[model samples]
Target: MPYVAVSALSHNGLIRSHNEDSLVIGPWTLCSTETESPQTLLFPLGTPLVVAVADGLGGHPSGDVASALVVRRLARIGPLLDSEEAVRDALTACNEAMYASADDDPDLIMMGTTVAGVVMLPRAVLTFNVGDSRVFDATRDGLRQTSVDDSPPPAPGHRTTSLVTQTIGGTVEFTAVHPHVTSAPLAPESRYLVCSDGLTDPVTDDEIGEVLRVHDDGKAAFELWKAAMDAGGPDNITLALVRVSE
Candidate 1:
């Protein structure tokens, strides 16, 4: 059976006073202040595994709490997800949970987060995202973005465009979440990058592909962080690199 080697990490970045990003690998969850050493785990061909990154809305209050809540909710549903519908349901549940939490508390009003994740199965991988966080598929041909950003299209010649059109708990009202979900056949020796905007905002797609090609899974993740920091890590950085092999 094929297995997956994963290297996941989260950093507070250079400017943030607090880390508002969260990550999930299978059942384990890590917040901005926490870190996970690189590790590899073998899963049977048909086993279901989940890997995700959540970025709290930096402009909103309690953004970290919202991000943490999103991942924690997903962790519970991760094991149960087996199909595209299941993935949508899981994300919807997360959205509801965030809204409910915020409704019950005055301080948590307007808390929101962007979520990007993948559910890897034996024969296929399902990718999903809400907001501007993204997932990318890296292969011999090139790097392709798999998840679509839920933000307005940038105007021509407009360089500064970083506004998300939708997100979990983005508004105080109860709004249905529309997560971008897609699936593709699983292939051996394939690599996938799931990350928050912190990394994408600083590093380019070419840079990401170069790092993945030159370094192993573990080092690739670290180099990505370095690339973002070297470019002035202005936001929280979080990412997971998953490689599939027989």
Candidate 2:
């Protein structure tokens, strides 16, 4: 039998006043939530399961609103995401929905989010992203990024940048997106990390890999959160550790 397990957490970090990161695990979603401890969920490998994070654009009004809308929409459509085209269409719909929502509300204009996550099928996993959030393959070997970052190369001494070339919705006008989509065969065992940049921006990949190597899935999720908090916790942090076993 094949099964999937996800351990996740979200926090406002030390510097952020509120958590603008939202997450969707299957049909369950979290919005503007604070969760210091790792919460684990299990499911049989059947319907397509989406594990993703949405990071609201900082310095923009109603960031939380944008992120929540994106994640909730994903949760509603997770099971229907069975193919690459389906995933792409869903993301496109999400982008359009952002603009639609913004149009209906004056304050929501110029609000947007960066999204990244994995869609786990029975025998394969599809990884997708927009903006600079990330999905990574995690194992004893190390962490390998599976999603594309939409920002320019970081300057010297910087791990990440604040400027994003594309996002869900940041302006009043409609902006199309070419989401990065890729698929890999699911092995007898595999693990993936889907997270907002808040986790990756402050913590180095080496540190994250070390924690994953030393800890189990659930504990690794907690340790990763702690590492970000220890490193000044500059932004909203949200993450999920997904494991598939047969």
Candidate 3:
């Protein structure tokens, strides 16, 4: 049987007054404003595993609430995610909950969050994302981004990308979230990373690949966080690294 080793970390970063990021790994879950020292878990290969990260949209009221709602919903729905349809349904339920909450409170109105995660089954891993938070596949070939960003590409001669086009609870009007989802066969020597934009905004893909190549699961996670902080930790950083083995 294959086995998976995982490590996760979340930090408020140097500039943020609060951390509006949430995460879940297997049975454990963390809400916004909660920080946990890096923790490692090992799962027997055939067991189902779910890991996720959510980043609250800055400049919005109760951003922490929005992000906390996302991961908590996923944690509740995690064990039952046995198929692609099930995953979609779970995400829809989360979206609806966010929308309903926003409708019920003026302070939470227009609050939104980005979500990215992976569900590991016996044979394959399913990856999904909404907004700019991401999932990446790391192997000897290179680091490939598996989740698509909802933001538009940067314009000519400009480094700035467009704002996120899709998210949970960004508006009070009825809107449907279409998450990007994909799957890949679980293979030895491969690693998957689920992270908030806080990590990617400061750390380049090549730099990420280099760190993954040089370290094991826990160390890689720590190094990634370090790199982001070294780059000034402009936002809240949250990530999970999962490594597969036979």
Candidate 4:
């Protein structure tokens, strides 16, 4: 059977005092099974795919906690399903998990994170997001964004960016659940890049595509982060590269 090759890393950028970004790669068992060892924090590459990045709300208390909780919830997903609906359901579980954590900690109220991830199988690619963090499809023609930003588009005469209209734990209302989820067929020779705004906000899509085109997936992920840091590294940087192979 063909397998997905996944590699990821998170860093505190030039400006941030600490990295609030979190990532989850590989099976949930790996995360839970080695709690007492350093391996608890890392996962091996071969298995049904689950790779994601979470950017904690910058101003919120326990922002790192919020992001880590969300990714951990995703890691816990077992008996994994490859369909789009299952992906949505999994996200819902992440939302609830974040909320439950917030409920326990007074300081964490309204705390949330931007989540973007991909579930890949030989037949398809299911991509999702719940904030400005994004996922892109890299094709021979170029890189095209796959998920829509949950934030509103920049308005006329407005110079600054806006917040995500939907997120994992922004509000208590049930209908506030993020509606920006979509999936489509994975193109052979096509490469998927899932990242937090740390990378996109600083680097151009063309640059991202060019890097992937020139390097292997693991190196591509690293080069992308290096470029962002070179460009001043304004925020936390993260990138995940998943290539569909023959």
Candidate 5:
């Protein structure tokens, strides 16, 4: 039988004071960790498997708290995310919980996070995201972004924009999110990359593709993280590589 494997890592990056990012793969979660080395896990094919990253919104209070909250929720509900609607409903619950947390605390107002990842089903994979975090179809041929970015066009000479159009929870008033979710057949040797903007902001898709072409699995993950650090690692870095193997 085929199986799904995920190699994940998280770091605060060079500029960030601390890691506000969080990760979830099935029932496991990592919040505010400094894991430059990749940690890999394997899961059987039949059950639902979720691998995701939640990047806490920068320049917001309790960004860490917000990200941690969402990823933990994802971990708890991972096995049930077999369809797009299930993923959407889960995100809605997370958004509501974010707002409810803020309402109960004065300092956590406006806390928010961007999420992106893939859900591995028996025969297909679902890619989903909100805000600027990303999901990518990584193959030897090239790297293709599967998740839609919620940010507008950047200014001249700017590689990226910090401003995002939507997120899980960014305001005192509750805001709904239109998450980007797409499905594709899950063939053997299939691979996907899920990450916060920390990896994409400084590194170009072409550069990332080059790395994927040359390396694989944990090595690919490490090389990508190195590329971001070489580019001056501006924000909290978190990423995961998912592959379906026989």
Candidate 6:
């Protein structure tokens, strides 16, 4: 049997009054099933799976709502879909839903969120993103980030590196969709980390690796949050760690 240890924390940070960041684990089960079904499966087709994430959107009206919406949408993919086309279609559906919610609610105007999530398959590791959030692969060698930022076109053609150009419900129209999706073979004894920019921006990448190196899931999570707090936690920090064991 494969076991996934999930540890997560959300902080208001030093500057923000409210936490705009959110982390999700097993949300697929939570969102998919209802009163009729007591047991919900996130990936019905996979044997060993770990899908999770962290989200951070610029604190705007209903940022929290937007984050939750994206996480829930991604979580409920009934069975694993191997093709990129299927995943892209799922993202498009999420965008439409988010846009509709924002348009319907006056308070949720301009609501948006950054997402970083992972999909574990039988033979490969799939990580994807829509903003500045990131997914990192942690192995005995070291840690490596998988996704790139999808910021706006830098100068009509080029794209910005650090800004968040595409996210859930950021635009009035349902267009301007930019997704950073990629897949790679899963490494043996490999661990994965998905987090919001809050954790990456305040805490150095080296520090993050060290924390993961020294502790298990719970301890690593606490240490990460502590480091961000020590650095004045300018933004809400969220982290999820997944270790694949044989």
Q: Highest lDDT, which number?
A: 2
What lDDT score belongs to each candidate, Candidate 1 first?
Answer: 0.85, 0.93, 0.85, 0.72, 0.92, 0.66
Ranking by lDDT: 2, 5, 1, 3, 4, 6
Tell me the tens digit of each residue's lDDT in model 3 across 1-246. Answer: 678878899999889999999998777787765354678888876656788999998987788898889888787778787677777787787889988997788778888888999998888898988899999998778899999999988889755463889987778675888877777787766689999988998899999999998988788888999999999999999999988887
lDDT of 2 by residue, 62-150 (tens): 99999999999999999999988999999999999999988898899999999999999998899999999999999667899999999
Error of 1 at 106 (Å): 1.2
Consecutive 10-residue window with the lowest summed lDDT within model 6 = 31-40
Indicate the residue-level lDDT of 228 in model 6.
81
lDDT of 5 by residue, 1-246 (tens): 898889989999999999999999988999999997999998988879999999999888988999999999999889999999999999989999999999999799999999999999998999999899999999766789999999999999998898899999988788988888888988778999999999999999999899888988899899999999999999888989999889
Q: How do all models score by TM-score?
A: 0.94, 0.98, 0.94, 0.85, 0.98, 0.82
Worst 10 residues of 5 by lDDT: 136-145
Per-residue CA lDDT of model 1 for 187-216, tens digit only, reads 878789999988988888889989987888
By summed lDDT, the worst window of 10 consecutive residues in model 1 runs over: 36-45
Backbone clash numbers for all candidates listed: 1, 0, 1, 0, 0, 2
**Residue pairs that clash (backbone atoms under 3 angstroms), model 1:** 45-122
Candidate 2 — which residues are off by over 4 angstroms?
none
| Candidate 6 deviant stretches above 4 angstroms | 28-50, 54-56, 151-162
What is every candidate's alpha-carbon RMSD to the true fold? 1.6, 0.8, 1.7, 4.6, 0.8, 6.2
- For model 3, the superposed segments whose C-alpha errors exceed 4 Å read 33-37, 157-162
